[model samples]
Target: MAESPPLPPLAVDIDGTLTDDRRRLDHRVPSLLRKWADAAPVVVATGKALPYPVALCEFLGIPTTVVAENGGAAYVERTDELRFVGDRRAAEAVAEEYAAAGHSLGWGEVDLPNRWRETELAVSREQPLEPLEGIAARHGLEVVDTGFAYHVKSPDVDKAKGLTAVADALGIEVESFAAIGDSANDVGMLERARISYAVANADEAAREAADHVTDGTYGDGFIEAAERIRAGVD
Candidate 1:
């Protein structure tokens, strides 16, 4: 087997890396993550909102910090404390731009305004490119084409920034970290790590950017990556 990189702090993306297509966490992946957590701090950096990944961490019984809302927020699950990092002013500006271009913004919690835990915006599926461009230009937000949904978020609020914050808090250098992900949003976290992995089902862009591609999908892919890290095989 090829020699794997040294054990380092692990930062993983949630949606496609930790959860299966059904959005369920694999039974095996949690054990592997627990093993790594015992060795070093394991952080979950994702674009999901707080409650989503926080529940996952609780289930895994790992001491994990979460980056949610595409980097708009960070939270320490054990403490129930949160940090808001994204530039809201910039986000508002982008929303205005989208409005001017005749595109409406849809929130993940559009129906439950008071209960919405975080701010997430989706460009109107009916909107034309002009509005999309305006939205992107105004807030300096990136337009993520997810096919089913177009995610618009502040450029600074991303998985990479979340991982960086975790590293800083832990006093670990960037070279001593590994990241695994499977989406365009995961790109930031992947790029920040000393080692990066993409799952078999990863999108083309993600696969192209990854240093290594796992053979499996979802939680199985994470298990594969963890085994490689444990066996010292890259």
Candidate 2:
């Protein structure tokens, strides 16, 4: 005679979790996510710049709530709230030091990744990490590698903080949400969510941090996790 638990809302990663290995949007994903949005809130969290995730929510027909730039910015649609982690002068200094040390920003002179980024900086993954970490540390910043790129940000800021902001804005606790991810930047979110899923192709840290590891990869993995969450199955 025990009552069933409530279905949790979702906070999801965009790139490797929603896109295929080619990083292309899986045509099946938007519609599936749109369906889920009808029943519960679905947060599209990503390490990309703010505009990307926000626009994604619009196109996907989900709430525009999102955590972008690897926790550097949090947007809550319900309250029209937009918050940034902190001043990025430190991250900017890191980039200056990195450039002086003969390291390329990796994406070329007019790097598109850094174009709209407000609170952090992104270096292409192709660049070596040896001195980049040291450079960031000197400026009191941390460099997080999200598989697609390396993000220079404040040590205290992360996707978990963004999730907390979203929870607060929605007047709910984060424990009432399910989260899925495929990279290191998502580790904090996965660990804090009520239920966490790491796709088959997820890195070691993410897999180790999740409650479940999906059998599929990319968009398919998200589908699997979503179905399991709805079924209330582990």
Against the true structure, what is each candidate's TM-score? 0.80, 0.96
What would the per-residue lDDT of candidate 2 be over residues 33-150, giving only the tens digit for each residue?
8878887888888999999999999998888999998888999988999999855899888888898999989897788889999999999888989899999988888888999999
Q: Model 1: runs farther than 4 Å from truth?
A: 1-6, 76-81, 92-130, 146-148
| lDDT for 110 (candidate 2) | 82
Best candidate according to lDDT: 2
Model 1, range 48-82, lDDT digits (tens) per residue? 56776677788898985777766666776445567
Residue pairs with backbone atoms closer than 3 Å in model 2 (clashes) = none
Candidates' lDDT values, in order?
Answer: 0.71, 0.90
Model 2 misplacement above 4 A: 1-6
Alpha carbon deviation, residue 96, candidate 2 (Å): 0.8
Best by TM-score: 2
lDDT comparing candidate 2 with the true structure: 0.90
